[model samples]
Target: MRITVADPAVPDVVALLSEHLADMHATSPAESVHALDVERLRAPHVTFLAARDDAGDLMGVGALAELGDGHAEVKSMRTAHAHRGAGVAAAVLDSLVDAARARGCTRVSLETGTDAYFSAAHRLYERAGFVECGPFAGYGEDPHSRFYTREL
Candidate 1:
């Protein structure tokens, strides 16, 4: 798999992102969703990444929000359902963390649903060294979700 920063103009990345957002919404209530839409991902503070197969099929994507000089948040992480359990999510996440650290971020965090549907994500984050934490970046406590963080 090839992982790299994405150009929002690309249609495959856009379609993959749209599918990812829909899946997130499907797994939980809209209020519990924390994904960034394409328009929001175009913001100056966000960095979007795309992972594709050798033949250029979009397999996964994720984004990082630069919170400040040393803080960042992981958002919109997803892998195609057909590619689940193939390490696409982990590859994307590892790359995201490396990029964050290179940008001088000391901490990286994420908000994900607490429902059983998201158990795989919870485990992924934990294995990547993220630990449970109270909301950061002004996110108030929400019973529908859990927050995790790690030193980058």
Candidate 2:
């Protein structure tokens, strides 16, 4: 699979992000769901990426948002359901980390759900070297949110 910067407005990417938002909302309270929509992902501070197969079908999507002060945030990470166990998320995650490093970010942080529905995501971040941390970038104490940070 190939991973590269992509436009979130593309049809397939939009569909994938829509599903991601839906899942986030379904699994968490409205205020706890922080996944960005297509328009937000297109912001100047965010770099959206897509992982595609050899035939060019999108397999997953992830994004990095520059937070200034040598810090960045991971946003909208999701692997297509059919491609979940195939390392799509891992590959996309590594790419996003690399992108963050390239942008001179000294640290990368993310927020995910703190429920059984997010067990896989928790494992993924931990395996990638992210450590649990307090909320950052405007987020406050939230029982349903789990925050993580990794130094680049």
Candidate 3:
């Protein structure tokens, strides 16, 4: 699979991201859902990425959002259902981290749900070297949110 910068507005990309947002909202409280919509992902501060297969099918999508102060946040990470368990999320995550490092970010952080619904995501971040931490990037403490950060 190839991972590269991509536009969130693309049809398939939008569909994937819509699924991501829907899942987030279904699993977390409205106030606790931080996943961005397609328009927000297109903001100038966010760099969206897509992972595609050899046939160019969208395998997954992820994004890096600049948070100033040499820090960045991972956003909108979702592997297509068909590609789950095939390392699609891991590959997309690695690419997002690489993009953060390339932008001179000294640290990368992210927030995921703090519940059984997010168990897989928790494992993914931990395996990627991210450690649990307090909320950052203007986020306040929330019982439903689990924050993590990794030094670049």
Candidate 4:
């Protein structure tokens, strides 16, 4: 797969983001969900990355948002339903981390649901060197959420 910084307004990327939002809503209560939509991903502080297969099929997407000096948050991480377990998400995640590191972010953090539905992501982040932590940036403590951070 190939990873590239992308324009969130692209059609396929927008569709994937829509699916991600739907999944978040279905998995977590309204107030517990933190997934960002296409418009939100376009914010100036955020950088979007896309993963595509050898055939150029959209495999997954992930983004990093500048929270403040030397810190960033991972946002909108999602592998296409058909691409899960294929390393697509991992590739996108690594790209985001690399981008964050390049931008001088000393720490990278992410928030995901605490439910079983998010176990895969929890494992992925753990394997990528992220460790569970208390809420960071703009988040508050929530029993339904799990926050993680890693120092670069």
CA lDDT of each prediction against the hidden true structure? 0.90, 0.95, 0.95, 0.92
Residue lDDT tens for model 2, 1-152: 99999999999999999899989989999999999999999999999999999999999999999999999999999999889999999999999999999999999999999989899999999999999999999999999999999998
Tens-place lDDT digits, model 4, residues 85-145: 9988888888998999999999999999988989999999999999999998878999999
Error of 4 at 58 (Å): 0.2
Model 4 weakest lDDT span, ten residues long: 83-92
- Candidate 4: which pairs clash? none
Off by over 4 Å in 2: none
Q: Candidates 2 and 4: which is better by lDDT?
A: 2
Give candidate 1 regions above 4 Å deviation: none
Candidate 4 displacement at residue 16 in angstroms:
0.9
Q: Which lDDT tens digits does candidate 3 get at residues 1-152?
A: 99999999999998998898888889889999999999999999999999999999999999999999999999999999999999999999999999999999999999999889899999999999999999998999999999999999
Which portions of model 3 miss their true places by more than 4 Å? none
Model 4 quality (TM-score): 0.97
- Residues 29-136 of candidate 1 have per-residue lDDT tens digits of 887788898989989888889998999888889999999969999998989777889999999999999989999999999999988988999999999999999988
Give the 10-residue window scoring lowest on summed lDDT in candidate 1: 7-16
| Per-candidate clashes, comma-separated | 0, 0, 0, 0
Q: How far out, in Å, is residue 107 in model 2? A: 0.3
lDDT of 2: 0.95
